[model samples]
Structure formats: structure tokens, C-alpha cells
Target: MTTLPTQLQHDLQALAGEGGYRDATERDVTEMRGRYRGGSTLVLRPKTTEIAAAIVSRCAEAQLPIIPIGGATGLVAGHIASENQTGVLLSTERLVNIREINSTDRQLVAEAGVILANVQAAATAKDLLFPLSLAAEGSCTIGGNLSTNAGGVQVLRYGNTRDLVLGVEAIMPNGEILNGLSPLRKNNTGYDIKNLLIGAEGTLGLITAASLKLYPSIKDSCTALCPVASPAAALALLSQLQHELGEFISAFELISGQGLHFLREHFPQLPQAISPPPEWSVVLELGSSAENELKKLAESALTKAIQKDLILDAVISQSETQRQQIWSLREHIPLANKKVGAIVSFDISLPLSKLALFIKTAVPKVQDFDGNLRINCFGHVGDGNLHFNVFPPIDKLACNYRSQQTEIRSAVYDLVQKMGGSFSAEHGVGRDKVSELLQYGDPTKLEVMASIKKALDPNGIFNPGAVIDPRK
Candidate 1:
């Protein structure tokens, strides 16, 4: 597959028809975050599952690598084709369709190319909720979300993408179709192959559609910005809220002072949720069907926490507009981080008891590797995931610190491992974290993964270099 053979190109053109095939552009091969670029000669956009199957079947016969991309909003280089190899890009953009929405059954069937925001709107129209949410929801597609097993603000309550999806219909690397898109709650027929493909990052298969689980609509809700003295206090406050609010607690996110500073520095026009942000703050939200009950429960929890000095300052949203403004602050932290580029960004997870200590120890230890580095630590603390990013000093550019990337990454990852945490939490092991996975991954787990990959994709034509590399 080093070069696209003439016969293979002709076969692809014939299979995809005239308009479906085109020369790859810069946009086709580049990833989000501008960190990875790939080399692809041809791009294919098939309109139907049958057409996609034809394209994959032809490529499988030619033994050419195929890279699957959706929305191109992934942070990891999962969708980026290998630069050293010649491949074809397969996009699911034309597959956008919402086949079904059953409010009574609490399920929605969506095609791979349906944008996440549109899914949310559809659920809203049915008086239901699709709880998988993130800043990239506007552009990220359902296929991409399930592929990456994406996590977002509400993971504390609804879980990740894997939990939201009940079934999926995907095409195996060898052009075999797996039709497991059943909306059954309990099906113990055999091994859970649907779960395998959900988080495989397209290494296992190219997902075409899914049957997703939806939840009851939020009739009443409350959003608050709580300033705490430390991560320890933040966790304690979360515990208090959950004890009182129970399942009503929807989201609890941790924000560090450094992240707030980045927001103030870059997005000055945005209204601040909590002025003069504390050393550490949390954005807490609660939702319920009973109007006024959610806000009342939240207020009671905060009143007790404030009395105990667990929370210092707080701002509760009084209206839907204000609530959106508060969430805007939480969502824009990543944008601010992008504006002030990072030397290395980590999506790590830790045990609840270990989060506070890990943050305290890792910040200074990472900075010791390079005194001028700026660390921004924040994430969905309720679910034990953290986005720990390293940046250059205010006056310096990220490019200037490129040489220290390895050192910075090693410092953070080592600490995370030592604290009984994972190097990757939500973002999958794309090209960027392949080495990290090899280093930190369990040997037995790796062996099983390789076995599965070999059995399903023996020719190594599916997302060639992602998750697990092709055999040499």
C-alpha cells in the first residue's frame, strides 16, 4: 500500500461512482488541534451503507489502507492517515440521518454522520435528553463520538459514549457487515462485539449507525460556580452535594486558577462566573423533573457546605440565560487553552482519593522539569478525569518549548501512573498516545487486543496506524 496502484484506483473510482471519489485536499488529511497531518491521495464519500461496503470491499481486495474520518474534530490523530503510507480517506458526512426517535422506548437511532448537536435537538423535541455532550458537539458526529468513546461534562451522571449506545451497525475491515443495531436492554447472546467497536477508534470497524439511549427531559435545573480552597475541598463539596442531591447531580467540574487566568487573558469580553477565581473552583449542576425542587436541593447543599467552610463563594444561575452563560465559561476553558498553546496536553484519570494529592505533587514536579512552563489543570472531577496541560510562560510561544515536550509529558504521565491513574481517560490511543499505551498498557490486555485485531483485520487495511499498529 505504499503507492496507490493504477488498477486499485480504477476499481475505487468504479465502486464510488464519479462524484464520490476525489483527490485528497489538505483538509482531508489534517487533524484537529493542528498537531498531526497525514498523506492521502484519494477521498471517498459513499452515500449509503451498501456503497460504503462496496468501497471497503474493493480496498480490501487491493490490500490498501483505509482511514475513516468523521467531522475531523478529534483531538487525537485517530482519523489521520499515516504519512509514510498511501491511503484513501473515507468520510461518513453523507450518512447523516435520524431514522427513529421513540420517546416511550427511550431510544434514538442515528446515522454515523449526524452531528451531536442535532441529535440533542431531536431528543429535546421529543421531550427527552441525549446526555453525551462536549464543546465539539456542534461539529463532532455520532460516529466519531462512539468511535472515540467520548466523555463530557455529564459523565458523572450519564457515563461515557459507550454507556449511551445500546447497539451499532458497522463494517469490518475485511468488508463484512456487523448488524448488531438492536435496542434491547438485555441480550446475552454471546461476546459484546458492539462494545468492542464502540471504542476501537475504527481499528476494529467503520461504524455506520447506532441505537442510542436517551433519558428523561430536565424539567427543572440549577447551575452554580463554587469557589473552593483546594482540590480536597472540592471533592468534599462534591460528596456533600451528591449525598444530598443524589441522582439529581448532573455535572461537577473542577477548574484551576491557571485555567481561569487563561480565560481572562484571552476571552476578556466574556462575563466572569466567579470574579477573582479562587485557587480552585467547581461548576456544579443539578437537574430533575420536579420544578423548584432541583434548585431547592442545591441551595440546601450549598448552605450546609458554606457553613462548614467547604465552599467560600458561590454564584447560582437565576435563569436559563444565566445558566447558559455559566456553562459557556466552563466550555470555553479548552478554547482558551488552545489560544495559549500547550507544550503537552494530558487526558488522565485518577482514583477519587488520589486526585487532590496528584494535582498538588505533579504541578511543581512538572514545573521543576522546566521552570518557565505554565500548567493548567482542570476537568470533570466528579468522574475522576482531568485535563492536565502544560504551556510556556506568558511572554513565550509554545513553539519555543517544543524541545521540552518529552520531558514535560514524562513528568506528568509518570506521576499519574504512580498515583494509580491512567494516562488516557477519554481521548483514545490515537497516533499521539500509541507509545504511551505501549509503555503503560497491561501485557495481557495488549495480547488480547492484538489477537482481536488480527482476527478481524488481518490485512491491516482499517485505520492502519491507530490504536494498535499493523504488524511489521
Candidate 2:
């Protein structure tokens, strides 16, 4: 169904120059995470948007599928090439560039290949802030963030990548450039085209660059690790803090005692604040422009909560080193779990009030598979998002517990559905969750998405088997 002509290959090689393209070796076919593997005929890395466009246009003429890859950090197998199709892998690694940082407009225009951390650093250099902070910021690209509409620790205050984007420039399936990179605060345009491509996951188009919104850097900040009784108590404390601190409450992350236990057992180098961990812990952060009175405000707020029994105990970070240590504990849970063994990670969201009930019902069902099965629960409680991961059991009896993955997933998802929650919250449904999407996604919404995909990419050459399959 796909063809790669000799002339087009020569032209691509000429345009990209030496060492820009490679024949897909057996190792390259295997994915970075070892979850999804595919055989790609060619891996093409274009240094500029022009070269990428030319390669894409030639492929369009030849009817060859093009898979756009950026950092390959996505949890879902969204970037895996199909075995049935002859595809050209478009790696955006060569397109790494921060074109401009306009301080006047508080906008940072960066190529899709630029890593999220690099973009944040560029913004920080100008005394500005790009508040899209994720665990994978070190390796994930801006284009991947834009494509996935990534939600991270700062989503409570700054919002997701979708909210932070000012505009986007992408290459359509027909190899036409859709340049909509305007840093306007308000625009009554005919249609918001940037929104379409922001979360399309390279299914509709290849995101080339983005104009991102930046914020004024915070001069004063306060960080606290507080122990709570339960999820309800955590939510109650968050409500009280929001009432007191208002917009200064930048991030409020939740972690279970089990999650903390994992860190203590696995990451022994990280210091534990509480000797006997409470049922739940809340990592609260406040950012402000005024530096003089931040500590007093934070201490006073914690004192009030402590008196009311909302928080059992608290530890405030006194220095930047201490703050980083506390954060490292929160950020390294996923990696710690990975080192231990395989896990079934879920990014689910539920109603703030029903979070405790959902967890109460789901945790036991997951543990029923194996008693020693580690349930590492942690996420942004302010937005009701939880990264509920189930680690493989350590005992011989639980060796084949992976066979019950389907039952475990069903139990968790059923509880979420009963609570009127989304199965896939921040993470988009890639090929891994297509069946779940079809089961839980609204029929009318799915129909509209199918129609849009059909309209944009009739040939279905762009990232097939991603969010929606055309054949279905």
C-alpha cells in the first residue's frame, strides 16, 4: 500500500546531507521504553522546516506514510510505526532551535524539537517563566508536549500546555504549511486552528514550531510537605489553603503512604520528613512577587491547619537544597517503580469529593491479584488527577499476576466510571487505549473526530492507529 521511489530517496538524502538519514536497523525498530516496537524502513531527520516539508511533499506524491517522532517519551505507543506499512520516520531532533524570546510580549517562539526544559531555561534567562513543568521535561520535546497537551505539576495555577500555547505552525498531510504563529492575547479569527493541532498527536499534522505564553518569574516562594489523614482531608486542606493564599497556591500534589514507603525502600538516599508516615501527604507550594513575608504567611497557614487537625504534621523547606530534595522525592516515584519491575500506570481523574471512595474501592481490587502488589498512588490533587500505578508482586505465587492485568484494569476503570470520571485524564488515548476509548468515549464526540480526521487526512498517512483509526 506504500512505495518509496528511488528518485525521492535520492532527493531526501541530498536535502538532508550526510548522516541525516539512516536505514532502520533492528535496534532502532525497538522502542525506547520496550513497550511498543515496529519496523520502519527509513529514519529521516530533517534539519529545517523547509527540508521536512520537501521530504513530506515527496512522500505525499509517493503515497508513503510519514510518522513524526519527538523525543519518543510518550507512555503510550503513539509513535510506533506499523509493520504492514512502509513508513518514513521523521525525527524532529535536528529541528532544535529557540528562534526568539520577546520580553515585551512575554512570548517564546521555539521549534518543535526543542526540549521543554531548554525552553523553560530560555524563558528563565529573560526573567520570564514557562510554567509547563512535567517529569519528562528533561527529554520530552515542545512538539510532543503540544501534541499531547501535557499536564504536569503546575497545571493547577498555570494550566496545561494547551492553555500556555499562543499559536502553532504545522505541516498538513498535503505538505502545505499552516502558519498560525501569532502571539495575540485575543483574536476573533474565523476558526481557532491552533487548538486543532495542539492535541492532535501528529495524526492530523506535523507540528513544526510553537509560539508559547510566558509568565513573570516568581521572586518569592514557599514549599511545604504536610501529612493528612485521607484524600478528603487533603481536599479540605487544599480548600482552606486556596481561600487563604488565593492565586499564590501554584501547586498542590498528593501522595499516599504506600507511595512514600516505595521511596523510602527504593530511594534510600532521599530523606524522609516524617518518621511515621501519615495516610496521605500533601506537597503545597506558593509563589509570590514579594519576598519579605512569604515564610510568615506559609507558617501561619500551616499553624491554622495544624490547630484544626486538618494536617497532622508539617515540614517547610528552609533552603533551595531542601526544596529540591523534597521535589526529587515526588518526581522519582515513577522511575523508582520502573526499576523495581513492570507496572500498569493509569492517569485517571475523578470528582474531588469522590476521590476517596474511588480509591477505597479500586486499591483492594488491584491488591487482590497479589497481596504484596505495590500500589503507588500520587498526582495533582488540586485538579483531581491521579497517577495510579500497580507494581508487579515480589512473591513466587504472584509471578504470573500480569495475566490478570485485564481484570485489574477493568476493576479500576469501572470504579472511575461509577464516579463519573475519565479513564484517560491528562494523557491522551494512544494506540494502547483505543478499545477503552471506543468503550467510554461519547458516540457523538467520536463521530465528529472521525469526520475531522477524514477531512484532514483522507489517505490516513499521518500517524495511523493513534487517537482514532480511519478504518474503524
Candidate 3:
């Protein structure tokens, strides 16, 4: 729908209530990383599932594309509306409610618009843990998190957004409601529709609410910043720590010296934990119910690792404030990357054994494309996901290198494919990576995905150009 009828907004307002319809904010059009922006403006916020269904029904009749937006913290261009104006931008913001928290069930039912931090706070109130933590958790909504199947620091211990969700309540493309919000461990009733919508990036449907799994609140924990010699050394240290700490090992993050330099350059206010950060480092965290025992174990293990020369220095947190500071160092690297402006960033994953090798090989390959490019490689090493980003030299801006961006991206992605890794890991194949998915995706898999998209959203009105492009 190139130009929707102006009456459509009033029709949606009447359906979802006056407060639900409004012009889109700038944030609504731009993705989190500021890499991509859209031009649509019609925004709709429905309060309830019934109201959401009604809005979809009206759009379906009018054949208007409906872009479902959440907290708009997505790195991919998933939430941005189409290039053409007049598509209805449906937001789940008004669906902010925690309908249930059952300790016995070990689950919490949350509306799609509930801020992830709010859900964590609610679980904390119940003396339980939500286990999903992200830099954008304070603003990213549950809907977007689930939509992207987001991965964060705790994915090593728990899992991705799909792993945390038990069920979801969504509106299908034909304006029908999919009420699959059942908090069950084993419900072999049919196809796992809940998991289907969890990572579909809203191309499949507009998720309204979800039933999420919760865990026991961590009783005791330890956070450490261990500086290693190289990515290979960091991988070796991770193997040792996992053997020693086992499931208690909650997060194992790999950081590059380049990332630290970026941090110091951009965010000088953030306290540097280690002196002259090593060539590589890792922020290792352990969480468990046993008090004091985990820290003793960690301290002992770190001593052994030092003796083995696996780590050069260690900055273990002794207090909550200090732990947050250490984590702040890890979390702020991406912000620094954005400030420096990456020419191209890759969110790719490989087998645990292939990680160090891929990093080593991909670096020189990207540098070969242009020797002036500097790379920042880091992320959740425990889970094999790496946010490998390429940027310009310290004195240069990314815009100056824009002409070479496409070739550099292709070189990196081809290597990622040849090394038996994924081009898109935790970040879903939003509009940004849609073509990459098509280029590297398995033919059979793409065919099946197209089939599913056709079955669920035949009209192509549901996020038409996102995961799969609409028919010409």
C-alpha cells in the first residue's frame, strides 16, 4: 500500500482507542545502531490482544503493510517500516502488563510491551531470576527480545530468548489470534508454534504476550576480568574454567585490545579495570546457589590459570559495585564501536573449536581488502557468538571508506561461510541481512522458509521486505 487512506488512522484509533494512534517518532524509523533508517510514519499502539487483532483486521482489508515495533532497540532493521509510506506501524507499547508469575510453574507471563528490566525486577520481587540481561534491557521490550531470539551475557547459562519463552500470544496475518501462551514443559499437542514466532522477527506475526521461564535467584556469584595473551589463550582458559566451574559458569566473554582502545578513546569516564589491557581479555562470571564456595573456587582456579600462564592479569570483582564496573567495561565496547562508526559489523557464530581460527583468518582477509581498516572482535565466547566489527583508522571516519564497504562485507561473509559458521547469529535476519541470508542460506531451507511465510502470511502485508522479500 503506497498511500493508505487517511481514514485508516481514524479507523485504527477508533478500534484501539484514541491514545493508540499517532505519528511515528524518529526512533521508530531508525534502528538502534543508526545503520539503517526507514521513511514510514503512521504508527499504531494497541492496548489489548483484541484491539490488536481489530487493527490488523482493518489493515488486512485495506492491504496495508503492518510493521510491528517494540522497544526499537533492535540492531537489525527489523522494526523499521517499509520505504513506502502509509503502512501501519503497530506497536505493543500499551500491552505492558505482567499477567502472571507462578513460582510453582517456574514461569512468568508477560505482555509483549513489558520492558525486559521490568520483568527482571518482577522476578526479583518473587525471589526468582529472569536470566536474560542485555545493555538495552532497560528499554528493549520482551516483544523485541523474543522477536529477535536475542542472546545476551547469560546465554551461556540459560539460553536465547527462544529458550526463555515457554509460549507466545500473537496475531496471525489474517487477523486471527494465536493464543499459544501455555506455560508447559512438555506439550506435544502440535507443531511448536510458540518457538516459531519467538524468532520470526515479526514477519510471521505480531507477538502480543508471552509465557517466560524463570529460574531461582542467584544466591552467590563471582565476576572476573582476566586479561589473556590472545584469542587462542582465551579459548584455552574458557575450556579450563568450564571444566572447573561447570554449569556454574554463567558467562564467558572474549574482549580484544582494539575494543578496549575504542572504549578508552570514546568513554574515558568508564573506569579501566586492568592496567594496560592485555592483547586480549575475557570477563568470566560464575553464578550459583552456594554462597562463598563459588568465589573460593574461582580464586583457586585463577591462581592455577596464572601458574599455567593462561592469563596475564586478573581483576576479579570483590563487591557488587565493582562487578558492575567490570561489566560496564565489557558492555560499553559496542557503544564505543558505534561512536567510532563501523564500516561493517558481523554478528556471526561458529563451532567452539573454529572460533579462534575464524577470527585469525578473517582479520587478515578484511585487512587485505584495505590495510587501513581496524577490527574489533568480541562477544559471548562460551556460546560461540562474535560481534566482529570493522572500522576505519583512528583518525579517519567510516564515511570515507563507504565505497569499499560492500566488497569488504562480501570478503568477510564468504570466509565466515567457508569456515562453517553463520553470517547472522543472535541478531535475526532483519532487512539488513536479508540478502546475505539468501546468498548463503541453504536452498532447501530457504524454500521451506518461503513455504512457511506463504502459509502464514500469503498477502505479504506482514513485514513484507524483512526476512523474505515480498513477491514482485
Candidate 4:
């Protein structure tokens, strides 16, 4: 483990003041998923961007490493320090301030430390909507969302966090601030620097604040739980809904029976929208200018879908309580997955046309590798992303398949690549997927990423062993 130089520690303390730096706690240096363990001598919680910059500047001068963290809720081990790595964990929790809100422009400027749920609530208070949402919204910070370019259920409508953000203020590895926090909808002056840093995880810089785009408050929203015979039918239903409802289709999720079964086995208290849930089901959510109109269009669309044999049965939510309960079922699957334990988990995206075939072909391939494997496939089907996870046989434990992890992942990812899909979809390539990125990423694109990392962070202190590994 690299130990902080005594002199450098003293310097950092002086720069950040006594309250700024403290010994790293488990909370400061661990990942939410428990997939990785991180170690660091100190954790720095800077109250302001200026102080953050000062800390970065000193770290750069001293050739010390830094890990930029926010909320520490990321599934990938992006913010976790290495096993023996010594560095300062820079937390943005204190920077939790919504700087500005412009209802007229349908935008808001918020600091990186702002909780995503708070941002939603702030926009709601203004009678507007910031639609970048996920299960982690209550704890994940806007900065982490921007860092990973997080895509949630609403990607089918509002796009990812990158789409919701108009501008950002970041501190480069060298402590130089890039003030790109403009709320303009269109600025085609030059290269898109803000985007380059975004989704770069923290290798490029530390995002301090962002100017986010907001939408008009949702007027009429409708939710439905539709049971389909197969994934192909679900895709067809999605097309029909798009053709009929257009942009009103905010979320279209594909769920497998295994996910619901997991919930039933583990989280039985959670209500199931469907009593006798089908093997394959979908959660459809639509929002429009008029609730009554949206409900009519949705009902009409479902009727047509049912008549065409595209859907077997469906439950359209009649009230807010019903809608929330439907959503709760969708969101709780991941928690149940955790309790059940997974042999291997994958976040993959495919061409919409290839999604069904991929699932059909990949499931058997995984079973071929180990006949006892159970697959739980689910995610935002509207955007072609799926959280395809593998579990051991019902009587076995996850540890039973631990030795075959590489084979299991390869079976799924190889199929994903052959079908022209991404091995890593919305989940950014943190340390967990670095090898996969190197193996599957485009050669030229990887070369350019390395060049950008070198040019922007010559010291390689931003986030070592992250998206682009310097060791390579």
C-alpha cells in the first residue's frame, strides 16, 4: 500500500483545513455492490469547488493519486481505490447545493454533490421535471450520474443523464477548472469538451457542477403491466405502442418470470401487479399533455395489441397507488437479485432486432456451460438494454458456480458481440470492465481514449486502473 508522505499529508490538511481531511472510513472507500474493496489513507470532503481544486492541485504537484467519489452508490467499482492504493477520497457530499433554477428556460444549475432525488424534488417544486431517474436516485449524486452518463428507465423518452445535462463545471486532474456550465440548448462553437469528460468516469476530471435540462411537468401519466408470450411479442407491442402513442411512451421494461420469482422467494412483502404472472411480462409507462387522452390512447393501443395476440393479458393502473405499486415491483427486482445471489451479472445492449434472438441463443449457451444455471433477463427494452443475470441451480449456492465465472461471462458477452451488441451498456467501464473494454472496444476508439487520457491527465492521478488502464 502506498502511504501518504508525511509532508504531503500536512500540506493537504493545511490546504483543506482541519475538518476537510480525515481518515478513510469503510463508507468512503467501498463500492455499493460489495464487488470490490478499496483502501485509502485519507478522505477529503471539500465544502467548495475552490477547495477541491486546491486539493487536486496539491495532489498533482506531489504525484499523488486521487479518487473522485459522490454518494458512493455506484455498482461498478469506479470510485473504489485499489487494494493497497493510497490516495484521498474526494467526496462531494458537502457541495449539495442547487445553484439556480430557471422555470422559464426549463433548466436548473446544480452542484455535483446534489442528490438526484433532491434535484427531482427541486424541479417538481418549480413545477418542472428533471427526468433522469433510477432506483439509486435517493442516494446517488448528480455528479456520479453525469460521470457514468447514467441511463435509467426514462432513457426511452428523455435519454440518459448526458442528454439531460446541458453543461458542466469540472476540475481537471491538473487542478484547472473547465467552466462549461452554460444552460444554452445549442452551442455549436467547437468540440464538445463537456461530453468528452462525461462518461469518462473520473479519469478525465472531477465534475463539480452541471446545468441540467428540465421538461414540462408530466400532465397525464399511465402505467400498465402487460404479459406477453415471448420477447418478440413484447418488441412488437413496443413498436405498436410507439406507432400509436409516439413520444408519450416514457418507459417500456422487459421482465422475465425468474426476476419476479426471485422477488417472491426473497421479498414476498412486495405486491405483485399480476396474480398469476406470465413467464415474460412488460411494464409500460406513458406520459402526455392530457391524462384522459393518454389513458384513452393507451387503452386503445392495448386493445389492438390484445386483438392481434401480441399480449395475453394486462393490468392498466387506475390510480396513483396502483401505478406506484407497479413501479415498486419493477424496481425491487434488483434488490431481490442481490438477496438471491448471482453467479454472474451482465448489463448488455443489443440492436432492438437482435434482442430476442440474443436472449434465446444466450440462455441455452449459458445452460450448456452449466446445465444448472438459471437466467434472469430484464431491463429497459425500449432502449435495447438488458440486465441479463445468471444464477446457480435452485438447490445450489452462487459459490458453486464461482469457478466458472469467466466461462459464464464469456458465453453471454461473446453472444452479445456476435449479435453486434455492446458488452457494457449503460453501466460505464469502471475497473470491473476494463479487460472487457480492452477486448471488445474498437481499436481506434481505444487508441483515441488513451491519447485523451494522456493529454488531459499526464500524471494519471484522476482514477488509476479505471476505464483506460495505464498499466497497459
Q: Tell me the whole-model lDDT of each prediction, alpha carbons only.
A: 0.88, 0.84, 0.89, 0.89
**Ten-residue region with minimum lDDT total, candidate 3:** 1-10
Give lDDT tens digits, candidate 4, residues 1-472: 5878899988888888757877877877777656688887688888889999999999999878888998888777999889787788888878899999998778899999999999999999988999998988989999999999999999999998889989999999999888999979999999999999789888888999999998988999999999999999999999988898899999999989999999899988988888776799999999975555777788899999999999998899999999999999899888888888888889999999999999889888999977878899999999999999999899998988778999888878888999999988898888899999988999999989888888999989998988896685
Which whole-number lDDT from 0 to 100 does residue 93 have in model 2?
Answer: 84
The alpha-carbon deviation from the true structure for residue 116 of candidate 1, after best TM-score superposition, in angstroms, is 0.5
Name the best candidate (by lDDT).
4
Candidate 3 residue-wise lDDT, 1-472, digit = tens: 2656668766877898868878778889888888777877777888899999998988888887888899998887998875665587889989999999999999999999999999999999999999999888889999999999999999998989888988899999999999888878889887998887888999988999999999999999999999898888888998998888889999999999999999989999999998686778999999986575777899999999999999987888999999999999998998998898899999999998899899889899999977878999999988999999999987888899899999988998998898899999898888888889889999889899999988988888888788885552
TM-score of each model, paired residue for residue: 0.97, 0.95, 0.98, 0.98
Cα error, candidate 1, residue 189 (Å): 0.2
The order of the candidates by lDDT, greatest first, is 4, 3, 1, 2
Q: For residue 14, what is the lDDT in candidate 1?
A: 86
Q: Write the per-residue lDDT of candidate 2 for residues 1-472, one digit (tens) a residue.
A: 2556778778767866767898766544555446678767778888888778777787777767888888788877777776777778888888899998999999999999999999999999998899999888999999999998899999999998999999998888888988888789899878888999988888888899999999999899988999998888899999999998888998999988877777777888888877776669999988975674777888999999999999998899999988887788788877776666555778999999888787788888888877787787889989999989887755532335657877888888888888999998787877778878888888999999998888988888888888895466
Q: How accurate locally is residue 242 in candidate 3, as Cα lDDT from 0 to 100?
A: 85
Model 3 misplaced regions, further than 4 Å:
none
The residue pairs found clashing in candidate 2 are none
Model 1 residue 410 CA deviation in Å = 1.4
Error of 1 at 289 (Å): 2.8
Candidate 2, lDDT over the whole model: 0.84
lDDT comparing candidate 3 with the true structure: 0.89
